[model samples]
Target: MPTYQCFDDLQLFFKENNIHPNIRFENMNENSIFSMVKHNLGISIIPEMIIPKGLESIKVIPLELEQTRTIGLAIRTPISPAVKKFTEIAENWCRFDKNIV
Candidate 1:
């Protein structure tokens, strides 16, 4: 499992539901988590996008709860032209269709 903000959120979720899981690992990246799970080290809650296909040993189970993840772009000062354009495009895309959930 990760030792990030999402880890905290997952902990809160488990606590709220009274699910005392046996978490045997921590501070691992998504790929590391996948590897561990594939080797039967433990199960994990990872983002759907990061999951690779064609892994017969692993199962992709969708979470039943309604959840949303907010993503943002972080750039240092004195950004380049390409990065500025990309950010503009991303912002526009995010604002395009607010009603489509």
Candidate 2:
């Protein structure tokens, strides 16, 4: 897993489930984790959106626990029309099913 903020969350999940992972590798990013898993190094938990859908060498499994990451849009005050529209669209997009968000 990443040695960043996300690792804290993953650690929390592990603790909650009383899981003691014998972590053998650490990486800074998802692509490296994917590469490691692809090479049969070990399994990793990553955001579902990142898994390449067509990768036949790997299997994707859904976790029973639902996890979410916060996302944001940064715009200065006095927002332009385009920014306002984009924020509106983004808000609506997030309100939909995950498949469409």
The clash count of every prediction, one per candidate, is: 0, 0
Worst 10 residues of 1 by lDDT: 92-101
Candidate 2: stretches off by over 4 Å? 72-75, 85-89, 92-101
Error of 2 at 39 (Å): 1.5
User: Per-prediction TM-score, please?
Assistant: 0.64, 0.71
lDDT of each: 0.76, 0.80
lDDT of 1 by residue, 8-35 (tens): 7787778877779887778657778878
Task: Name the runs in model 1 displaced over 4 angstroms.
Answer: 53-57, 73-79, 88-101
Candidate 2, 3-54: lDDT as tens digits: 8657888888889888898998888888888788889988988766667778
Looking at candidate 2, what is the lDDT of residue 14? 86
